[model samples]
Target: MKIRKLIRDNNYNEYLMDPIYSRLLENVNNLNERIFQKNKLVNLQAFMEGFTFYTSLNYRSTPIDVLPRIISSEFFFKISNYLSARSYVLNKFIREVYQESSTPIPDWIIKTTPYFRSEMIGFSPPKNIYIHVYGADIVRLRGIPFILEDNLRIPSGISYSYKAFEYLTRFLPELSEGYNVLKPNDLEYLYDILRYVSGSKDPTIVLLSDGNYNSAYFEHRFLSDKLGIILAEPNDILVKDKEVVVKTVDEGEVHVDVIYRRIEDLDYLTPGLVKAYLRGWVTIANAPGTGIADDKATFVWVPYLAERYGMKLESVVQPLTFCLYEKENLEKVIDQPTRYVIKKREGYGGIGLAIVKDDNLNILKEIFKEYENFIAQEVLDFDTVVSVVNDSFYETYADLRFFTYYDKVASAVLSRVGIVGSRVTNNSSGGMVKPLWIIQ
Candidate 1:
């Protein structure tokens, strides 16, 4: 409350020009000056609108505290390596899981964990390339950075970050001085890579959406526009004679090259579509039948897996520790709920999360039963800084989600931060986003 009071008095404008704000502003300007020397005057407002639109959904994010909890590169590198290793091991696990089970992946922790589909198994992606695009959240423990979660499933925020990166350069032109900010029109790269991987040099890429009703419709539009790809819904695409094709008005037909599907879950894939993917006529990014790998239960073993798959190279980063939210664990944690958090086994956006200290145990029990969730990640404690918001100060937790792409080459990373207080930390989950600076 005190911080909120201070932030409010300062006003958003003043906060924007504060040290951290100014640093971010300077970094963007300098990067643009060096990199985009040919293109003058970046669009900050448009970028902000993109950020606003995506983060306003279910994210409970507030303004980022002026002072970021910075992690050293050595530490950051460790985290990155860990993610890489985990991805490899998880890939192995997914293949095994699918091989063993005819049924859909279950919610059970141990049994299902060994073969996490979402983690990275079953289905052909670029074999030489690992995770093409990865978005992992980090929170500080004491002073060390810890990985929160990984978003390999249709990771969002690339459009937001690209827009924001340009916007910051324009809004704070004075900040540009030394650095070269790489221009990130990732959608084109994404389309190209998907096509390359699909083994079609010039395939017709399609952006699949559940419908306009989906929360991230804006992102679907953004990517489609950027890549010059066709946007189609399930109904718009039809399967005939074992091939997936898009049906156009006037009874026209369009063949697909590769599918950049934006639909969140496998259930959304038309029944015949999965068969089409299996036949390998139509290609999908990250491919289908890989959802279970990223499941929460499998997450607990990522560190161990890294050692096994990565040839004893420790995981680059460490994930927050996890525990089951059974009655026994809940009873011990009831008193210090804030010290721990309870999350559903299958959750996105803090949907069934219970911050015990902030709420109550009875409520926690109900959530546990209803969601069959996991419990107690030692609260990711980090230093808090003040953020000025609407003439008020709010302390918010900020974490970065980096998007990486792997084409014919090695893997790379793209990063963004979710605004605080939002469980999901996704732009669609009500997060306020800012561009991540790759400071030299």
Candidate 2:
């Protein structure tokens, strides 16, 4: 078989003999060791510095011998534009459907999460932009990439992926040679969004973290340092005189005009702080109640919303999704369990997700009894990527996490691959990371 065919078939022996694969594999082995040791020491230092959750879950490691998933520049630009336009349509839908009290918005979309309360409904931000940062998870099935889910609120992993790219380019120059790889400047775009929303030329920006115990605290710290902004935990901030301020030993109380928050649960924030945000004293990157857009049930209506808003998404491929709240959809999913994957409406970190196959029909039925807000999607068999674990080569399922800043795609991508025999490709759920590259 040809090299591509060999890779597709997971023929390890042939891959080992291919000169290009062998050289790349050798370089990756060295790069992996260096990164492993460096990450180990950095993680230890981070833990000491109160990044307690950085290494606690064993999800921070760098995977080995995985070639960067290559995409053409044409496809990259097309998809980015599609997602950007789609975001506008989605935002319009949210504003039109959920902004008015009398409008009939689906209860499952807004009420699925506790954070989307009545008080927050109709609460419009300065620009009516709900999703400033979006992480749209795309999976390739039968050589076509389909958007699996949209994460509108507090999308993590951009900083991590950017750091990983820096490491790759710094340590493995040989691998990046001859390829027109694009580097992501997400920090700039992020700052731009903050500036735009704050309506300030040089806004006082602060990255809010839940605490050191939050799983993505390392990323919070990384972003704060990289973007040259203050990293404040929930306790470090307070609302005084209707303005959000961060307390510091050096400056006493520093006024914060824009806050790029990393926390998902809005309940953890003080009422005063939320009030300050609502009053426009402070701007939040992803405004509160934006979780409705990320809710799994809302994903079923995304294409329809886009079309209704007169936005064409001809280049985009959305997976066939059904909201379980509908009786017909529920029966359809329950009858043919193997044909679909079920997920909770507000699920995150790969939790409350199940892939129903022939063997798990009975179990899924029992599980379904407990879930009122759920979504079922057509089963997509993702393309396999080569990976090396313990010096042995194997093929694993992979998906791409494409980050977008205010409807523009971030230049870099974070690829997550599942372990052998697993379907889910979330880092928190034992998935490994790989760098993605766009070949011009």
Candidate 3:
């Protein structure tokens, strides 16, 4: 039995080791050996260093276990199909939304979604591509998986995906003995999609970041370095006469073909900068104003959007029960607050989410009154699974985030699962990750 001992605080001799730990260790060693043989020392070292970081971080990720959930190829195929359908639906919806202001999006919903910038009308992307990379959080209830949210903006953790394959495969050999884990080659595929959208053979690509203050700065740097692209700060880019260009520290002016902007909104951009983007001087990965589509209000219409586009695929997620902020709906939601999860329209990373319990109804009602900008969703206490904690065991909530890339040719996806204390299993909120295997 290959098990590594993990001792918790105040317990040195009282350590716990599952037999599976040793198996994982063996697998990691084998993967390291393979990478070491095939790649340059620098590449192998960077990869291994990332693996080590993730491995060490997992232990500190609350009182949860790191067990491998084997997925069948059959299930993989199903998930892939669903993701493809979702991509199609989202792409079509974004186009439709931006193309027409007269398009009847619900009146009550739009009032709450501040991110929906109407300025994006008639502004098509350089290609019919938006959301080239997608990370959708999903959860399971009674063995049925459902989507929680769609991540279109600067979705991080692909670097971790590449590293984890090397780490987990070498660490737990037995787990892979009969399983076919999805390959990590998809990162390059995402890059290729972006390049195609830019329509250039050797497009001068730049990964734009909001300086180092952003949480996913390390991942951005890793991607740019690996892809052999330039990483630029907001100050490093220059838009002149409705054209995009890069101004390096030493080099004067270099033309830019594509801008993979990781920066959200910047206050310093002149009117000329935005005009350059609108003119398609450089291709943007997510394209501006895409944040509008991922709003909770917009998400509610996904199933309808799918149906409208003649897509027969049903949503993996059940319709989330929400109040429309109307007088009738508000009264209903407030009267039975305990059964819901209150969320503000423009919230992120679990900021404005409150689980309304019987004991907190009065407080919750007062909160709703003070912060009148809220939509209450029915509580989705999804089922849990067991993961090991040293020698003892504990159960933690988990969510699967599917990564998708879309080009004119096709839309494909890779998925990752996060497990930890957070009901919202975003990595920023203390979640350990595992790969999503394609069932074949």
For 1-440, candidate 1 gives per-residue lDDT tens digits of 34325444544322332343445444433543342332222323343344334233442222221222223344445665655555556556555555544332234664533224443234444443324455566554344456666656666656655555555555444444444333444455566567676676777878888765665666688778877788888888877876778876754788886777777564455766756766766777665545555566556666665565454535334645565545666655665567776665555655655566555676665654643456456655443333323334455545556454542211223233344453345444445554444433
Q: Evaluate all candidate structures by whole-model CA lDDT and list the values in order.
A: 0.53, 0.71, 0.59
Worst 10 residues of 3 by lDDT: 9-18
TM-score of each: 0.73, 0.87, 0.78
Candidate 2 local lDDT, 1-440, one digit each (tens): 13344465653332333333454545555564553444444434434544323446443443333355566678788789878987786677667655765333466556555546466666888788878898888876655668998888888877656655665565456666556677776578777888899888988899988776677877888888878889887888988887889987888899999988888665556556777887889988788777767778778888877777788876769988988777788888877888998888878878878888623665466446855677888987766766545434556777788888886788777877787667787767777666677666
Model 1, C-alpha of 272: deviation from truth (Å): 1.0
Model 3 misplacement above 4 A: 1-65, 249-252, 267-271, 357-367, 370-372, 407-422
Error of 3 at 309 (Å): 2.2
Top candidate (TM-score): 2
Q: Report the number of backbone clashes for model 2.
A: 0
Tell me which of candidates 1 and 2 scores higher on lDDT.
Answer: 2
- Rank candidates by TM-score, best first: 2, 3, 1
